[model samples]
Target chain A: MKDRKPLYLMTPALAWLTAFMVIPCLLILALAFFRRGLYGGIEYTFTLENLALVFDPLYAGIFLKSAAIAGLSALIAVIIGYAAAFAIAAAPSRRQPILLFFAVLPFWSNYLVRTYAWIVLLNREGLITGLARWLGYDAEMPRLLYTEGAVVVGLVYNYLPFVILACYAPLSRLNPEIAEASRDLGASSWTTFRRVVLPMTVPGIATGFVFVFVLSIGNFVTPALLGGGQFQMIGNLIYAQFLTANDWPFGAALSMVLIAIMMGLLTLQTFATERASGAKREES
Target chain B: MASLANPRLMLAILAAVFAFLYVPISVLVALSFNDGGLPTAWTGFSTRWYGELLHNRDIMSAAFNTLVVAVVSTVLATILGSLLAIGVEIRRRKGRFLETIIFAPMIIPDIVLAIALLSFFSLLNVTMGLHTVILSHVVFNLAFVCSVVRARLKTFDWSIVEASTDLGASTPVTLVRIVLPVMLPAVIAGALLAFTLSVDEFIIAFFTAGAGRDSITLPMQIFAMIRFGVTPEINALATIVMAVSVIALTLSQRLNRGGLPGQ
Candidate 1:
């Protein structure tokens, strides 16, 4: 009875997950191999055309563009977030919790609201344009909204706090003595950070980077609203295939590819984390 | 070491980052109160838009649907997740496969899950609605709740359970009398977090909600409104939604002082 307790306790959740998550994901994999019907329904016959179409130049270009945008957003988020985390870690210990709390507070709010906030600020009659006009010689307002920059900004804004939290974990846990030892060895601050602190914090950086990149690449909302329906990230393409275009097979194929990219990044992140911990163990 | 770097430089970075995080949100909140409700100029402060929100049937229905989904899903997730956490933690041999199964929902891209569930439902001929949205939301919500409960369980002492059994207390009685009290805070914390996530979750709900205006959630409504254009009513609605999530999450963080979900 004692041994069986654990099994019984876990059954409901396991059953729920298998019925909902696992089966659905596998169904998507199967759906990708089928053909689309003339009327937008799934055809019973199996075909690899959807997979081949994913690799075609037209769709492939969207994938590359999505990767580039996700990459750029990840890079900017890491830089800004790392700096913020570093500053928080350097603050007085008493103040650190309050600071970190406030830093992460906005992240818990409605993501659409946060994204909408950007639209309010970047639109033609937005605060930025208004500020520019107030401070300036009369000139035509630049098109700030409905651009690639707006999408990138939206992605970074929505995901930045997670990066800060990730980076701050390693930074906060870091032994200051390690940095002091480097400084005492006559290394400059820059050299100390690059060679000593940065290497140790690679796990955090990897986690943050992979997280932002994966989410950004699959993001449809930011591109749809901020890109003004003009920019077509892989997310937008997939959305069209499913909702508007009614190409379920193609959508599933694109999703499989997205999952592949995500798994690859996640595997890399795990390797980085393991290596970082192994290095720490050796150092001690 | 802290003295080695310019304190002023650190403060500047902190200031800049905080501004980046808060400025956009602050703008939305401020604009919600603007009488004219246009970004171009603020005529005066007014609560007219918020008043308008009350009279808007679409917004009201969506808000009610969101409430139904969030409450139902959070309850279901909390019970299942807490039990799973206890079971997983109690087992002496934890497999990597089991860990992956538990963690998958947290890391899986929202788009992937959204479409997967969408496809799965349609294939089964299950009519999608607020109920389907609730079902899908549970997939991720349970994962989050489990992790939180599991984090709390990490510091849990099994000796107490052993002692309770030694006293001839039955397992169910021990769980009810001993375990439940100790775990209540974390359980509630996890439920609050789940509620917030469900309320704000859009993509999955959007996909699984089928083609019906009645089942629309707050975030889906917000997304549709935002695409058309930002309006003063949306500003007011956004403010309310943000406030609810912020408050729930703050209470969650307070209870589960160990860490927030992602962190």
Candidate 2:
């Protein structure tokens, strides 16, 4: 095996990725500086106009709104998912895998189908309304579908499994003795959890938050389907720029911005995780 | 403290979550068989929707296109991914840059990759179709397959390969007779996973399928039909698509000795 130098075997996959992914991404970075053609083709002429356009109030407003919605969804998902993961980890050890599987199964299904399920649940004549009417309240049903709440619900539901998986890590690995020792020292369960458990799980929550945030912020599907064209996220804007508006360079620029936002969040998340892990090690 | 995690309450919540996830799917499945299409009312059961799907030319063509893409992409990815996994593990150093590049396809927002591919294809004047979509799908699919195979390979014993080589087996001969046999299950599992992913993938396909009705894959068709508003046929199609993914994943899991937890 030593004589063979297996690096040659790695070349095909590396070459394929570089040609398609790395090079293309770099191409988009370069393309962002070029001028948009009058007829949607890119002109090689250099300009900062595309990046400047992203900062313009109209698109900037969408970016802020997207961040708000993504943040809300991530926050809510982590709360529910952390509680659930805590419950599962606190269960018998033998059962954790099965519980986690069920928790994550919805995530592996078609993304469109999962989002569509919420449409069935939230539409005017949908399940929630049907239940409301079934309770004999004949008042006009408020518009629920295509709202900000519905979008949040879709994002939370779609990204919730990842939250569970992320949160489960710290929960399952948590040393019960520390919490017990805290309790023995006269701390109440809530106090122990607040002072100890929560701090321990912060890194997991940060991870789940960043993941859900990054994915949901760049998500086109939920906004397209659940928000129903009334609201536009960065993802939907990018989609429209490419497909509907026929503006490739602009779309490329939006994608670059999206990538930058994701990378920034990810870097922050990594730093948070490293710091937390360091604290954990130091305490140990 | 124990009562806070009440067994009944936990069971109920678990049931509720599963019901929340599964009921709509089950409803879609049932509605596809309903003679009447509305969710509000369920008439007698029938196979009419499935029959209709079978005969629908557009859906059939889309399904065919999806199959072609999935099969070709999965095969290519599995081969590339398996070899890459073996290579990386065997070599095992000084490729952090390559590792990040390979892993980027996995973590990069799908929209970013999708539009990047669209831009890349157009910039190259590459004629886009199922072919271009296949190329794009392979980019990510290979990453997934490599990860899966590499996980299994981490537990692999290298001495046998060394011993085989010492016994004068050629590299190609040793790979075929030794490494391939040991890695067969993982490769198949990886292929199934890749196929499932390729089948369910929408965004990249949406961008790279070019300007033609001919290249419309099932998910793209599903997206369009969905936008045209809910139909029993879509419910039927959704049920089928979900079933394919579930079955593929379940099979892959069983083959993989319990699938990767995060997938």
Candidate 3:
């Protein structure tokens, strides 16, 4: 009877998730296998053409490009974020929370507003140009806004705090004794960090990398607003299929591929985490 | 070890990272007050653009729509999510599938969820409006609220509930008189977080809101204005929106950490 109580309590939320989240996701998956109607609607005929088109050279090129951009952004963010997290963790313990709090505060702000801030900074007559003119470089200002670099900067700026938080978790939790023992055994600080500290924190690095990569790859807004209309990432392709071209099947297929990539990364992250913890267990 | 690295280097790195995080935002806020409405040059400081925002009907309607969506969705999400959290924590046997379902809304790309909900509603022949936005927001909002509440529940003492039950209190009575009061702070924190998220969320609201001016949210309005170009009015609007989110999230974080030792 007591066990049944939990089931009863869970029913409402489960029902809600099933109706809204689960069923809708399943609907999209099913939609991917159907044909597009002549008039911008879905037809009830089964077809694999939509899935096949996702692997076509043109679309596949976009996928590879998106991955490259996402990977680059993740790599840069992880480097910067890891350094910030390490610095925070090394700070006086009393100051760590306060520092971490402010670090992540910007992340809580409106995403669009944060992204739009870049526009104000990078636009033709924006702050960067104003500064350039102030320095007496009176030639035509270089185009900074609506470029690939702008998109990469926007992704890094938006996702950096998350990476910092992820990295900080393992860094702060690290046992100091192991590093001390490494030093006592004549190992240099760099060697200690590489052999002991970095090994234990692989999970954090993996988590941050996977997170930034996943979100960046699937991002539409950053590319749309910052990369301009010409830069076609997978997200923009999906957006075009749904809202512009009215090709729902193709859009669904693209999203499925996106989901596949996300699942793969996330599974790898979980595996990395488990392995790291297993290594820790062996150490203790 | 600490002596090996220069303290100046650490401080410099910290300063540089903070500058990278904050400089653009500070520039936008400062320009919102610029008398010259263009970013080309700052003539002086003025609040004229803020006054202009007050007179814009499109922005006004979008703001109103956003409030409605945020408030309604936050309430529904708080109720559903708190219950779900309590239930899950009590069961203590959550399967991998269940955990994935709960976590999915947090990590799923907003565009995918937006389109999925858009497709779902349209196929059901349901009219899209602010109501659809509210419904869709609840899906993600509830997940966030659940996670927050569940985190709080981790440190909760189950013995109190047993004590209340032993004294002949009914389930509802025990829940209301015992559990709810203990969980109130976290619940409020979760609600605030949900409210802030719903207010700022754009893509999902955009796709699910259908084609209508009546349902346009503040973020959507901001997006449209941004696409055209940056304006001082957008700066004012952005400042206000960012302030609200920062304030709400700060309050939420404080409340979540309240009564915890050394926080």
lDDT of 2 at B75: 89
Residue-level lDDT of model 1, residues A1-284, one tens digit each, is: 26568888899999999988999999999999999999999898999999999999999999999999999999999999999999999999999999999999999999899999999999988889889989984788779999999999999999999999999999999889989999999999999999988998989999999999999999999999999988799988988888999999999999999999999999999999999899889978
> True interface contacts reproduced by each model, as a fraction?
0.74, 0.45, 0.60
lDDT of 3 at A48: 99
DockQ for all models: 0.72, 0.53, 0.64
Superposition error at A163 for model 3 (Å): 1.0
Q: Predictions ranked by lDDT, top down?
A: 1, 3, 2
Those runs of model 3 whose alpha carbons end farther than 4 Å from true positions after fitting are B1-4, B260-263
Cα lDDT for residue B36, model 1? 93
| DockQ rank order | 1, 3, 2
Q: Candidates' lDDT values, in order?
A: 0.92, 0.86, 0.91
Is model 2 an incorrect, acceptable, medium or high docking prediction?
A: medium
Q: Calculate model 3's interface RMSD in Å.
A: 1.8
If ranked by TM-score, best first, what sequence of candidates would result? 1, 3, 2
**B28-111: candidate 1 lDDT, tens digit per residue:** 999999999888888998999999999999999999999999999999999999999989988878889989999999989888
Poorest stretch of ten by lDDT in candidate 1 chain B: B254-263
- Clashes in candidate 2: how many? 0
Docking class of 1: medium
